[model samples]
Target: MPFQNTMGDYQTRQTLETFGFLPALTQEEIFDQIAYVIAQGWTPSIEHIHPSQAMNHYWPMWKLPFFGSVDLQQVVNELEACHRAYPDHHVRFTGYDNYTQSQGSAFVVFEGRR
Candidate 1:
């Protein structure tokens, strides 16, 4: 017996790995999310990688996670700095939960030009 294909030639659209399905987030929304993460006592971190490699490779951290950081402006400043330094790379923000030893929240803040 031979196997039969159920669907034929269906093409899928490739999108960004994070927050791709929804509308893009504004600066204010991003700030709010960051503040929430901090209030929850989660450490925040930024990571970036070339858009082309976003799906296959792990992004490198922009700097050490802002552990015990209470200043929201400082985290925003770092995020801006990372965007300035790597304008052509996809930038992502993450909140690390110490209790779960895993990421509690994450989303792409910037999408690189294709």
Candidate 2:
């Protein structure tokens, strides 16, 4: 069957792929979290999602297909939830650092940092 174009599925897959949720993750809530990820700033590194390969980590590879939006807090929540569900998936971040002085692609991530 052809894929059903639904936001719920997108949110679920994105959350699972990026955050590593197993089964208990609800489809509806993750969508909300996705919105929060972009709204809060900070981009999910390519490695954050796909850790096996770095050579094709840029774009047009493992991304592009699964590129969906999720604001910062939601990303943090999703990651934390996944960490709780699976210990090995526990990832410790360097925390949110404001590098607003940088440019290109990252300009948004560093925005508001003085």
Candidate 3:
């Protein structure tokens, strides 16, 4: 993937990228990773799309996403709810810091398995 600035435009970055995923990461692992992202002062947001109609552009999962919240548990709960709600669509959680126009991390907990 190319670098994306906060403006939803592509740009290069001097910083190293941080990201990871697994089909088998445990719930505790997810919480730990999210907690680390929250500790970085980044706000988490979710995005999902249908596997059949995948778009090149990113689509937000929430209309009004929580910004700069320090509540990791609540964020995790919201992720769980999203996973439950869209069990058949690809879903991802991404932490963004709007000020820097940079995303701290992104995780895909569900792959829309049938």
Q: Rate the local accuracy (lDDT) of all candidates.
A: 0.83, 0.32, 0.67
Off by over 4 Å in 1: 1-13
Worst 10 residues of 1 by lDDT: 1-10
State, as a TM-score between 0 and 1, how close model 1 is to the true structure: 0.84
Instruction: Give all TM-scores, in the order shown.
Output: 0.84, 0.25, 0.71
In model 2, the runs with Cα more than 4 Å from the true position are 1-23, 44-61, 64-114
Error of 1 at 19 (Å): 2.8
> Can you write out model 1's per-residue Cα lDDT over 1-114, one digit (the tens) per residue?
112233341124345544555567779999999999999999999999887888865789998999999999999999989999999988899999999998899888887776
Best by TM-score: 1
Of 1 and 2, which scores higher on lDDT?
1
Better of 1 and 2 by TM-score: 1
TM-score, model 3 to reference:
0.71
Off by over 4 Å in 3: 1-23
Which candidate leads the pack in lDDT? 1
